[model samples]
Target: MEFEVQVRGRTARRWIMFGMIALGAMFLAIGLVLTGVTASFLSDAKRARGSVVALEWRDDDHGASGKTLEHDTPVAYPVVEFTSADGMPRKFRSSAGSNPPSYQKGDLVEVLYRADSPEDAQVNGFASLWLLPLIFGGVGLGLSGAGTAVAMVRRWRS
Candidate 1:
């Protein structure tokens, strides 16, 4: 009975380790795909200079209830306006937002977009392009490294 319990415990630990590693690997794969997509978009993207015309504000509750004493801060996303390569006017709200607001009204920023779809434009910056992939990849590496370390310790103990 004692031996059976010990074997079951080992099996459970192994399964948990495998689960973490697998999940991490999946995240890593997703990050890699996103990196490729971002690279491809940048390669085909056209550049234009845009100015912040306005700011769109929204409550960033962080999943907390309004009833709580803690107040939710508003996040500001910049609304940019610019002329496309085809001399057509375009406007788009940035996907990223900040608490204090990253951009002020009339602040000029570089924009990147495809000529065929100028409305779907993004601010040309490192944070706009590479932040997501870096985050996913970093998390994946941390999780996978932790799982591997656990496995190594277990093996060493045995």
Candidate 2:
């Protein structure tokens, strides 16, 4: 004989608990990856002075031409030029992305790069270097703690 089971509040809460655990796990994994990348960058980077050559902008409006200029949400990318230790002039785009343009053309900025290859250079700032890991790790820790607490509470209730 086929059996029909009635869903209870506890069963629904258990499903919710599982969902929270999954979300928390996903964030934790991303946070760990970002932390590792940040660690690698900090280990062997040399500081150099670079100048912003120009601002590159990309419209966020998904190729919607003929739209009003107000709809153009352009993000600014700073193109930096620096001379490596080998006396070769190298130009690279900063990895930092922002709206309203944090830098201007001809602005001098500090850049950090590996000595052997200057192409993988990044702007020398907390926002450029550690912001991603800090944000991901903070959110991951909070969500994971909340999920663990919820699982414990559900277990106690059962």
Candidate 3:
């Protein structure tokens, strides 16, 4: 006996395909932006050692869900500040949002900054990482979405 898989069922497959395509597009966009930002930071890091900086939560605006609009407050986070290769002081927020450290106006933070540029630096072992992955993820999603859309359209036609 021979078995065959037929794409006949009217199913959620269409939705799934659409989602993948959308995700791919989003990831692609994110990746591009991250690449640029990371490149700029890298140049700065090469020039000077990163300096520790304080990040005070700014004000809060309307959140998407609006469940806790006040949650947007910029509690304190450890940040790395350094001059870029172009002699510009750039500050990067720390990746310690899970449980931000108590911050003072001028708290001392340890950072490994580049000599040529201060903007490119890692603070408290936190670097501006994951930007690339995010971007790629978006691109992959977009492509997947496009493919899914095609598949779904074919299925619908049949």
Candidate 4:
């Protein structure tokens, strides 16, 4: 009975280790794919100077009870207006936002857009282009390293 219990415990540990490694690999793959996509976009994108025309507000609460708090503030995403390569005016809201607001109305910022789809412009900044990939990749490396360390320790103990 004791031997059976020990075997079961080992099996569970193995499964846990495997799960961590698998999840880490998945995150790493997603990060790599996102990095590639960002690189591709940057390669063919056109740069333009845009002005922050307005701020679009979004609720920060993730579907919690609709109680309003004085300290709670809505995230403000900047809406930028710029002219495309062909001299046509275009507007797009940035994907990233902050609590206190990152940009004010009339603030000029760099914009990147594809000539074919000028309306699908994005703010040209590190946060807009590489933040997600870096986060995912870092998490992936941490998790994977932890799992590998666990496996090594288990083997050393045996």
Could you say which candidate leads in TM-score? 4
For model 2, how does the per-residue alpha-carbon lDDT over 1-158 read when each residue is reduced to its tens digit?
12323356657777777777777778878888998987787788877889999999876455446564766687888999998777888899877767989899999998888897788999887778888877777777777788889988867987
Writing each residue's lDDT as its tens digit, candidate 4 over 25-111 gives 888888998999999999999999999999999876553667766677799999999999999999999988887888999999999
Q: Provide C-alpha RMSD values for all models, in order.
A: 2.2, 4.1, 8.0, 2.3
lDDT of 4: 0.90
TM-score of 3: 0.44
Candidate 3 lDDT score at position 29: 71
Clash tally, candidates in order: 0, 0, 42, 0
* Candidate 4: 10-residue stretch with minimal lDDT: 60-69
Model 4: how far is 153 from its true place, Å? 1.4
Q: lDDT of each model, Cα atoms only? A: 0.89, 0.81, 0.58, 0.90
Q: Decide which is better by lDDT, 1 or 2.
A: 1
- 32-130 in candidate 3: lDDT tens per residue? 777676666555544345545556454435667755574465445556676555666688876544235444546565554656444445653332355
TM-score preference between candidates 3 and 4, better one: 4
Q: Give the alpha carbon lDDT tens digit for every residue of 1-158 in model 1.
A: 99999999989999999988988888888889889989999999999999999999987565544452356778898999999999999999998888898899999999999988998999987777888999898888877888999999988998
Backbone-clash count (model 4) = 0
RMSD of 2: 4.1
Q: Sort every candidate by lDDT, greatest first.
A: 4, 1, 2, 3
Pairs of colliding residues, candidate 1: none
TM-score, candidate number 2 = 0.79
